[model samples]
Target: MMVRSLIDIFSAKAFEIDPLHFQDDDIHMKQALVLKQVKHVLHKLISEDPLESLYMVDIIQRLGIEHHFEEEIEAALQKQHTYLTDFSSNHKLYEVALPFRLLRQRGHYVRAEVFDCLKCNQREFTEKYGEDVKGLLALYEATQLGVEGEDSLAVAGYLSYKLLHAWLTRHKEHHQAMYVANTLQHPLHHGLSRFNDRSIFLSDFKIKNEWKCLEELAEINSCIVRFMNQNEIIQVYEWWKDLGLAKEGEFGRYEPLKWYMWPMACFTDPSFSNQRIELTKSISLVYIIDDIFDVYSTLDQLTLFTHAIRRWELVGTEQLPDFMRTCATAVYDITEDFASKIHQKHGLNPIHTLKKSWVRLLNAFLEEAHWLNSGELPKAQEYLNNGIVSTGVHVVLIHAFFLLADTVTKETIAILDDIPDIIHSVAKILRLSDDLEGAKSKDQNGLDGSYLDCYMNEHQQVSAEDAQSHAAQLISNEWKRLNLQILTPNPFSSSFLIFASMLQEWYL
Candidate 1:
């Protein structure tokens, strides 16, 4: 009895929206004016109410635009740390956690004992303020920076995670619940980059009507910065084209954009544009060589290729398979280019370190390949000890240091050679993250097994879910190791930390 529909019934409505609708025609002028006013407000607060100044910086960071006011933020934090000695005595739990997190994140050495008072009074604080959602959220985010043996911080982390989950379950449809879910999965402390491109930060400011101009200005500035980044990406894309490796070939995957995105995530500042491009090219080469070992090469060919890399010469590739020859020559050529640039700029050639890293990487890859082919699954620890090297973390760090170091000294090289505790932890993190993903997708099981496979095989009674949970625990422990290491004195540059943070972020 129903009439037939005249229109196509399956099509959904389009949801096109302009992000910059808040800005006027003179966007540049408006942005500059807003920036000035925001700075004035910030300065005014610093003198009138220093606590509000710290809170404002925290808000700016949460909004994902603190990079624009790094100097002012740093100066304000320094003042707070210098002048506000007894401030923690009077503040709430959220207030206590906020400054601790902000200062630690920026490399200021705030002691873990700063939270000792809160820990001692935990019983009373929970009874009176347990349901203070804002304080709980702040305390939870702060716990992400927890270190090894920090029992109170660890307890806080667990409790906050549970409370946040419970809150989200009760208010599943709330916008704040969506944010809590996101944070529970990948906390704001480590996953800031993921939110960099989202409009949620902007939306929050717009809805509040405070700092709305600053958020609008951030959008325009981000747009301009993104355009510049696109230009840099194009140059790298052109270089990939020159390598002639992007052509249809069974030997490897052609994903120039994919490679570029990693370095972009690692170091997004415009000053490091060239370094990002160079690192992208090197990582791209790594992927190509990895495919050769993982998917295409015979054991004999892998051995030969390993020897060629060890020899550090293109001539050594004369006896290899054609595919390997392409890879070897390209690796050698690109490495030399990086070494040459460093030599010209810094008067020190890091070619030896670069070559040694590649040799180690190849040896690790060959070991994994041998394990898979021989039908001998290594013990979990045995696989991880070598798998860490195979993660190519040392390779990435060696090249990253050379590019970013203002002055490469002997002590720095020795620290790098020893592989600092933080760097080692980073390797474990990357390897675990990779294996967890590979297990889920059945991707790394082509010729080589994964951490999950090894773990499950080692303990045949363990289910896949249990194995994964175990791996997740290992990753969390390593993050604690890394968090502790970063708090201490180290020889690594700020740029290197930025790179390391990005690597951790990718897995998150």
Candidate 2:
């Protein structure tokens, strides 16, 4: 049977997990923990009616009540570092005379530190980074404004919208803070290493509210640090002498799947269904899969394998592989089959769009192999080929997403049409930009140069924008059409902002 993550089954909306990753587990584990914890708690509270788990909101209130009393007592006792005084002052920093919370809520009662993290972090930031850290605290508070835009929030009326913005805004703040923390004191260059401690310098480098980008920046920083250390390079973080170290709080972990080919749990959209998480999943999958292809498979065999999954399903014990392949094949079948079943169960259209897309992607992968014979340095525009070089394991991740999207109801598809376009556009632009960067380089040691085959003794200049004279251009055109669909109508939304920002980073 197909075992879905609890997060997948519950249809969570944002970044909450079952148990947070141990202080700082892999991001995937952290994602699963938050989602599972949320779903589990909600399931417990509502028992027979998990959908009505809004009752848990009262628990937050109750927690707030006790927290408030504790705060008063703490203040009366002349406590300086408690949450109440800090968050309250942080609120005041914004020039808003509003109470720390809208009501009589307090710190003692809220459910431990999980639900009240922004407040906890607010206090921590004030105590450590100084009260001047109000910009982040302000961003946290700003989510309280009337939540507009999304139809779901619109239908929820004002109160629930406020609650949602409260949480979503907090998440945005967490990502922003993490971006700052991981990037701080990390050198972009050797000469620049000495300036890492400059707070003014740090102020200029920031990752915005979007989860994916911040997560990526943090991961890349860690990867580079590890790579440098392995080579015995000078440490970048040595400059923080006498500056009080930032206290470590719990971050999340990665929950590895049975199939290494499957995505890291972290990228699963807080609200992903069969369709959307594919984009995020691809953020990891492209590179991993590229590695597999580069090191493992041949072109013809990969094509055969692609064709197999299009119709493959686990039938009985008889068809299983003897070892790890069985597990991977099982997951591969389950992800695709579950998506097909969900649509079938709901009487949704049987498009099999994902399967079709995967076949196309597989063919694209195979085509890249042939380009090895093309006698030219592959550029970024050769996306189907360079998924390994730029995006890495995420190249074929859209196949999973396409499956999930097809499974969702047409209403959801309509609402989330922007997602697919965002994925394709970002992937395409990044691929080209990365390749062009390599083509333009003389050093040939960095990202651009490392991927460039400088001495292609027999050269063919395939147009960066066009895959080929025939079949490739059609596919490219279709991809562009999808992007155009996203950019039309409401082009300035958050989804678009992510799309545009990633494009800007990849390109000019």
Candidate 3:
């Protein structure tokens, strides 16, 4: 599907779609002042209804303009947390779940047991609240945050999924049905882009005069992001053309624009243009390296390549194939340049740390390469234990932390070194999503074996359909772990959480 999607993107003519146009710069400048007033009016309006305040925060975030009013949103959530705690028993499912999700997403320490208040009534929830699709959707969204041993949420999530599916099937053409389907496809943290593409959210918020400003602001911000991203992508294409990496190998799957979308999704703010460019270049290199290991490289060549990465020096470049040499050189130069940027800006030398991440990434690749050659099928957990690292989440997080941090300290490095629960959870989700979707594909021979294959091999009685379902469940559970970890006290900057969430969108 990725290959087909890329082909469609590249094969299409530019003139097939209409170009986006906006007013002159002077007109946009005038609207900037209006935008400020709209933000103020929005803040004041949300301040009146605490529940609506939290809901609007969620909407603003989905609209991709939360950065404009971060302080105001933060203050509102903090106060809402206090108020919600005092009157905890008085709210409905939508009331409690909305604030809970918003707070935890912003790095607050809301407990999983907060949903304990709803556990005893789960059996009657659907029968009594079946018509409350909004509340059920909110409950379903909140359940995405379930951690280990949160039985209440596990049960609630199962019910919510079924109920929502039934509702969608019955009201297939309704707007609410469309919203539920979109939520199931991409949950809140990852669904912002798709949500913004539709007009429902805008119309829902346009009922009040003050919120009209917010709706307009979202439209303006979305346009800015679209324009900025298109220009940056053209620049990246020029850079990729100069490198000639795509022409050197037998592969035609090298898609720079597709790779750019991941980092662009992560850092949409105009301030991090450099980070987006740098991350895109590096991740594209990762895509190349992954293909080499999975398809092109022999076991002997992989060993040499892995050793070369571990050495982190150009001692054995001569032993590699022409393409591998090109890849290795690019990795070393790009990462070292990244480290240099950190050193120059923050006065901290991160060369070793950055290299360490690359070494670990390559080692994980080699581990899987070796496993594939041995004709031995490891258990699902064993493959996943190493497969998560191979997903490149850890390496990406390392770079993101250094690239976006205001200050780099020893404590921050230590926190990054620990492979916190958040990274693990993301890695798990990526691994499962990969296996689940890959199993459905007909082109399986040349690809690396997936977790679905491992599960099927281990349990001969389990059908492929069952195994796929199992993998889907694993992805959902890992999401819970990922959600829980973001709320824990941590040294990571909030930007890392946003990056992790963006990764969920990418891999899913």
Candidate 4:
């Protein structure tokens, strides 16, 4: 069907359709007619054919569910209002979109195909005609999305599109990318993009996101699995499996689910363990030296689906599956080792109540993930929603906080309570550092902000520099602030201090 073919031609340039450029309404009418016909073809297949069994199902979902939403159309309409000012052509699209959504929701599978058809045609229209003739096509595309948090979808789609476009330009393979980067095509991550292309084109650049590292990790995993003792991988897996992680199909196939398996994936990889693997690798020291990137992650720029444990504890975990628990404990042990090394040398007692608090934190993270996965959290404010802080990677934050706290309600489990407060402080500093990093990148022309900014801005003294990168002195000052908060600073806590110390070096 033309719907699938049109999938190869889509993105921002296609959806911003303008109608005033054409004086005759007939043109708009004709465009609408073609879209309707294309919809008819798609409707036949979706309604009557065995499309679910086909790989094209991915493509169909993208076009139907991801791209076409009522709010998507509204946002596009707002953009259109700016250009057309008083144009009614875009209204034609809304008329088409409502019925499309209803059909799809009702499981009128074949009729729903019309929406996908409209999206494909509109994408083609935008590519060919720009904003001038995109009217019904743009509406058709936008209306396929959900009304709730419609703006987020736009933001994410735009950002992904921008990065993917970058990767495509770098590789100079526009045609193949056309389909691979087609946002209207559904299964957003399944497609290729500028991020993928750029990372591949410049593999040597220390990347700032998990996905960026994914391809490398995969290669690393294969090598690690091949060379290392399967027994070693199996050992960790068995331990985790026994502890309630490492089982397949436990995670429900989303962001949290992905992170639940990350540590294991890394461990299973032989290449990843080799320090020579690139620069450093004590696979056991999963300090996830790399994910430090999460401190300032953002969806529009870049987002790390993992975080936490690096701070103090996991967010919500009421339903945190055993698989995630196993995953969390294993990785926390690895990362905490480094933190403990720092803590011991400095005379600070790293939070040792992980065993006691694991249940509480894991429960919180499970709830957080469930909420996030279910879309209960509105803004994804990690501090506010806890779940916002990297649903799965709470393993990292909880562990980090475990090493940082002075004391918690020792009444029940000594030192465990201090963790929540310590996590806030750490999350605050990290947020500042990240915000600076993000703002700095925006200044430099292609960097995404980190999680650190949000917290830093919430409390504490935040100083904005003309230069986006964090100043060494300022970061030190923040650390000193923390030190002042605690009278007996851990004299041995210099390594994690390494994280703060390296701010200037990493970003500047």
* Candidate whose TM-score is highest: 3
Model 4 gets an lDDT of 0.34
Candidate closer to the true structure by lDDT (higher is better), 2 or 3: 3
Across 435-493, the per-residue lDDT of candidate 2 in tens digits comes to 44445544433322222342221133633223222333333343344333433443233
State TM-scores per candidate. Answer: 0.87, 0.35, 0.89, 0.26
RMSD of 2: 19.1
Taken over the whole model, the C-alpha lDDT of each candidate is 0.73, 0.34, 0.75, 0.34
The stretch of ten residues in a row with the least summed lDDT in candidate 3 is 9-18
- Across 1-508, the per-residue lDDT of candidate 3 in tens digits comes to 2434433443352223224345444435745876787667657756677677776777777777788878878878877777656535557778887887788778787766777766656558777667778778888887776677878878887888888888888888886665677677667765535224456655433436656666677666766666666667788988787776766854455668777866776786767888888888778877788989998989999999989889877687687788888788888888888888888999887787778778888998999988889988788788888899999888887888887887998778776775777788888888888777777875544334788878777888998789888888788777767776787776777887778776776555
**Tens digit per residue, CA lDDT, model 4, 1-508:** 1112222232222233333433343443543454444344434444454221111222222222212223333333233223222323344443443333333222222222232332333356345333221132233333333322244323333433444445556655544444434433432222222112333223322333422322332333223233333333344444334433224353222122122222322222122332112111122222222232232222321111233443445554324444343455555664456446545655544345443333344344344344434443333145433522322223344443333334423342343333443334344444444455456556433323233333344433654442333433344344434433322233222222322222212122
TM-score of candidate 3 to 2 decimals = 0.89
Which stretches in model 1 have alpha-carbon errors above 4 Å? Answer: 1-34, 82-90, 120-127, 194-198, 201-210, 251-253, 440-448
C-alpha RMSD for every candidate: 6.8, 19.1, 3.3, 24.7
How many clashes show up per model?
A: 0, 49, 0, 76
Candidate 2, position 105, lDDT: 19
Instruction: Give candidate 4's error at residue 261 in angstroms.
Output: 14
Best by lDDT: 3
User: In candidate 1, how many Å is residue 460 off?
Assistant: 3.8
